[model samples]
Target chain A: MRFRYQMWTVFLAVACWGLGSVAQAAELTVSAAISLKEAFGEIAAQFEKGRPGDKINFNFAASGELSQQIERGAPVDVFASAALKQMNDLDKKGLLLAGTNQPFARNRLVVVVPKGEAKVTSFEQLSKVGRLTIGNPRTVPAGQYASEALTRAGIYNTLLASQKIVFSENVRQALAYVEDGNVDAGIVYATDARTSQKVSVGFPVPANYSEPVVYPIAVVKDSKQPDLARAFVTFVLSAQGQEILQSKGFLGANQ
Target chain B: MTDPWFSLRLSLAVATLATLVVGVLGTAAGYFLAKSRFWGKDFLDALFTLPLVLPPTVVGFYLLGLLGKRGWFGQVLFAWTGWEILFTFQAAVIAATVMAMPLMVKTARAAIESVDPAYERAAYTLGKGRWRTFFQVTLPLAWKGIAAGLVLSFARALGEFGATLMVAGNIPGKTQTMPLAIYQTTQTGEDTTALALVAILTVTSLAVLVATNRLAQGRPW
Candidate 1:
């Protein structure tokens, strides 16, 4: 019994130690799209190394989901979405600081398939594609772009009717469907496609077929760390930031 | 207002259906375990109660794998019927049922075990058949416990999130049940809508708990 008590006491001490570190960290909560996980991790490392006084806290999910959280009063310091609509909507609600909302980077919509299986080079080819996985358009910006591109290609209704849709909650999950070889193809942001070595991006959908893909960043109106948020935003739009984005296959905002 | 109402209706519908299926199956299984001796009875009991200890995500992921068109059983069914169950209302029902089954079974097994076996023996000696003895004597004595189990199942089914999302895919007006709605609203900063729905769920869950407690106390018995 004494041994068991000692074991439990040690276990409790370890658990409390784990939580204490998390509670004590100087966290800056930045809500971002799921696609930004890899990029943000690298950026956070550099940002922390330079600042040395803070850590970046990321709340990553579909842009729609993150936008809702901000509007509903989540204590997020920064909002970086894969699309402008959600950020713009938040701005319209006066939830973002003026002059804070700006396009920082861009990404393209791409058709992705399992590596070395088949190739798709044109938008029109999507109509004949089998097992197309897409994020739910109602909540994911990448899915909306895919919808617009498919509609412009005049294959939206055909693809819808084929009823082969596999809806993931976010672009990352949609990308997983393609990477895991579960679906023959998936529509995901070019940034998301770049994350996986198991899948190869087939081709970019023509820009004319859909609205320009842009990532927008904003400081929350009630941010406790607006300066830090702005710094992160500026870093994203800076030449160095653009280089990082470009290296990850993301388009520069200036383009 | 309209969105919350729709979400609430969907939640109730899903929960009710799930409770009905799980309550029946769980009670039957529980009764069998409590009273009958069978091969691997202990193992079967453990298997049935596994979901109680298992994480919801684990259950949800397995459901996703099993219900996807390319999955082992799903592929066969899809080929036979040209149908896909994943990301559909049917899949939501399945997820809720799986998540709620353990609660129903656990509650029901305790209730069944609490009954005096002397009652069953008495009925049998009076020449009552096994089925008749169970229906007339055992069931009536255990009605309160069964009702409590049903309510618990309903409450569990209503709060289901992870499994439902994994299986149903959150298609609005199709598979976006209440929990998914709340998640969507919260994710997008629709605080008013999210809080309102949460209030509704809280009230409903409280009512279920109170009602179950009253029944368990044999208030109406």
Candidate 2:
């Protein structure tokens, strides 16, 4: 009986410790789009090295989903979205700190196929493919961009009506589907295609085919560490940050 | 990119806590359901079993509605304590507990029910109180099934993903269990990391299931 009580005491102590650790230091929670995974990982490391005793925790997901989380009161310090639409919606709701929204980087939509498979080469040829995957337009900006590009090519409705389109949760998942050969082709960000050696870019959707893909970053209005969050944003927009983004196939913000 | 082992450690901690909670609550509920006969008992049983049959995403959606900041209970909690439960480690444990409850309840109920009632009758005749009779007589005989149920529940909790993701949000080193890690790694094109996580989860689940089978066969070592 004594041993059992001791075990429970230890358990409770550990649980309290876990909860307590979360409150220590200046932990900055950054909710960014899934496509920013590689670039932000490096950027966060650089930013953290410059500022000791501060940790940056990333929550990567669809920008729309992240915006929804912010609206519903997620404890986020910074929000970096893959598209302006999600940021604009949150800004309209007054969820962002005023004057904090800034365009950080840009990317283009590209069609990719399994490394050696090249039957479908262009947006118009997407309809002839057995299966085509893209992020779900409702929640993933890449999907919305891809949908617009396809609409410009006059194949979006045809692909939809023919039931040849598979909607993924995010751009990375769409890229994974193409890489895994589960789909003949997928429309994803150019940066996403570069991450996987198993998938090759088929063609870049013309910039005018859809709205220019601009990435935005801002501090959440309810951020506990607004200074730290703003600093992280500035670091991401710095020359060093732009270099990392460009190395990963992203266009500059002013492009 | 925190410690690679963070998700594994978090998952173990969450599963252990969730199983401990389920062990106590599920066993009591199981014992009560087994020994009692009441009006609307079938409805109650169905209610307890619903989580097992419903899709995990549906269960997660319901949790989000109940525990989200704007939710009824969540609104009260936030107003009173200024503490938001969503995206926390506690939320992962709660999601695991809800997901593992049905398994524990069903298995424990069957175990307790299978025990002959004559043993309880003898304990009562000897002037033993109900609580003592249950702990001394009923529990000893039903422990094997209950133990098996606990093992299965632990495994279920370890793999709980959908609900945890919905309520806990995939905060690495915090709420990212092995399953969530696997999903995230795969999506991020980190096949090597995903493969490793998948293998670890598969082996752990296999060991747990094998132990459960042994316990259920009445030959636990």
Candidate 3:
């Protein structure tokens, strides 16, 4: 009836509003790791406020996943990965603009347990007591770092043989497993662990605990706005961007 | 090629197993509802119809709560067998089955209801037993509808994503299905593989749907 037509009209109006695009000087498409969501979001806001004409669009996901998107020609201007291996591979493939791929930030890996857990306080105790959730080492750099650290601690194979470990698609999921109380513990970046209130860090691995977790940023060779890409990368390495990242529990790439 | 094929094989395997389960259970449940008038029938109908309306993620999240290791049923099973079902192929089948069952049930119930009660009364007067009358007379008349519903159910099962991901955890070479593979690849901007997987899924579902339509039409082909 008349009411139904009005409802349809309202729905179409909302849909059109959603589909409308904003006019801007330039849109800088940046692909960053999911673990960098908070830091990058804040930095993007700061950048936007400073230059109202330029807009920043971020595609956040796992570093490996982001790199693969960049590899296959996603419309991304800047690529930032949580792990160096993906950036190194992209650079080797000549996908990055020369001299633009630089380490912007670093992260530390930590083991977290469900909030208010009673057992398994220390890193070594994890092998004896709780199911451990880890990212797949084959695809996730955080997983590799975790496995290496466990190997150094001499418990990787033991946990494997005991079938005490499960794997997730990414670091955030590992944290989720712990947060949901589905797994006894999870290995994730310190920044990821911090994002979840339902989980708490049980222990932080040493800085040189395993492979270094340096985040590398680069301008894509296919970038249409190479100058804009360079500017964004420079901003990420700038004192302001570094301060924002540090405030979000990330370490500087150098220190 | 083989890499994507693994996901395709897993998707087909999961959908086939799920369709088989829902096909039998849905048809049986549909027939029961059509023939019987019992307490809480309206409530049961609403419950069975819910999956069709709710978001897949909501269904998936509920499945996790019910079947996860710490869940009531899973906790008991874990205590008895030291086995948990989450993050495995079985969980994927379960997710697909849960998602596809509602469509089958709804379609099947309507099909069975459309059959005349006079045929059952006639079979009974001819000394045919209940089960025999149902199987011989009522079922044969209504089977095309059920088959169509089952095929549609299979199509839904193949596209299942959120619930499957919630329970099965998308472990490659294990629980990863074509839909999840497409999602993973597309997320990473691996479009060639993703597009290939998308085409495979589309063609298979479309073929099944066309066949369903043909069967429904009683076409000679």
Candidate 4:
């Protein structure tokens, strides 16, 4: 009888410890696009300030890489993609929480050259450069826009045939090529181009280039913290969140 | 549809070039480390072996800084020639060489040191000079181990991804080696092509390992 009493007390003590940790704050993980790193970091800090006990972790990478991780069942609660295609694919796969998808932001594509460089002033001049870097069109949304823009401008084949084009894994890498002066010019998102001090926009691609760059976000279906995930998504779609994204050079969905 | 063998040929070229360079340089470093006793030898040994435990991306990051236009040596070269070498096949070769060098040096050093000291003493008694004795005696016995290290370095160079990606920038038909192609193809949802490339790499790596092991062990039969 005495031994049973001691065992019951120990079990209660263990249960109390687990409950105490839970009260300290549950962790919420959000996987976002590499381009969204700065914007989302600010948003997460704001979100965390409201819920003192909540801790948010972010995994940032290329949209394709992040989507592939989600497809492989990474323990992600929220996914915000820089492009609609990745979110759309996962939504079609029935892997996203129903009705939680929201179009939060958009971005424009631009061509950039290294600081103090005047060799190429416009997009049409891209064909003349020896090396013009852009993200890989197969997966990067910004690259798709650039490729389509060049095609519409009637210079895609010219650049390809001339071997004046190079590919980067993502938008920032494209910007880096121009920033480092390794390439004569590069095409990347206007937002990404702004992050570098050593590169400036040479020109903005026309709106007729490709599909509009839309950023869609949603909660993953298998989230362990569904309420928290939905709440975080709600916070991002809020007016203040849109304001922060705009400050970072992103556009409102309506724009 | 884009020549499927393009990436494979490029990979072989990079690996072969990297192996040849590392073979000569690494062997020399290994011989010195094994044969000499100097101050700070442990520190020097640690520096050479450090890459083995570091992530390839970290090595690539350092190499990028070292070879970029504003880098240490790069600033000098660019100031003189108004050009930088990043995003070229040469950059890819450099990355692979930096990454694969440690393994070759470590293995070769151990093998050279394992050569019996008694044989060297006997050669000295016969009035053979140090250089001739080393060339005739030390090198012959250590050849198999050096061969094994070279093969291993070649295989490691073939799969180099992160550093190559950082410095070389994945351009198809230009800087894209087999492993880079496999990763890019996989990301683009071309799983079949990626898997095919992976299979080719697997077979080539296995053949390299088997052939080298047989030769190194003197059991060719």
Candidate ranking under lDDT, highest first, comes to 2, 3, 4, 1
Candidate 1 lDDT, A34-67, residue by residue in tens: 5665566567677778787887766555676566
Give the range of the ten consecutive residues with the poorest summed lDDT in model 3 chain A.
A15-24
* CA shift of B106, model 3, Å: 18
What is the model-wide C-alpha lDDT for candidate 3?
Answer: 0.78
Tens digits of per-residue lDDT for model 4 on B139-179?
Answer: 88898889789878988888899778666655455566778
lDDT of 3 by residue, B1-221 (tens): 12576666677677777877998999998988888999999899989989889998778777877776656777787779976676567788899999999999988899899999999899999999999998999888888888788778878988999888666654445566788777666543345777898998798678756755665555633
Ranking by TM-score: 2, 1, 3, 4
Best by TM-score: 2
- Kindly list the per-residue Cα lDDT of model 1 for residues B43-69, writing each as its tens digit: 998888877778876687677567665
Report the Cα lDDT for residue A202, model 3.
Answer: 82
Instruction: Give the per-residue Cα lDDT of candidate 3 at B58.
Output: 78
| Model 3 Cα lDDT, one tens digit per residue, A58-142 | 6555676566556544446899888899899999999899898889998898888899996456666888766899988887788
lDDT of each: 0.75, 0.84, 0.78, 0.77
Model 2 residue A244 CA deviation (Å) reads 1.9
lDDT for A119 (candidate 2):
53
Clashes of each: 11, 0, 1, 0
Which candidate number would show the highest DockQ if scored against the true structure? 2
Chain A of candidate 2 compared with the true chain A, TM-score: 0.87
Expressed as tens digits, the lDDT of each residue in B1-221 for candidate 2 is 73446676677778878988999999999998998999998898898898899988678777777777777777788899998887788888999999999999999999999999999999999999989998999888898889889888988998998778777777777667788888778777888988888888788668656755665555624
lDDT, residue B21, model 1? 89
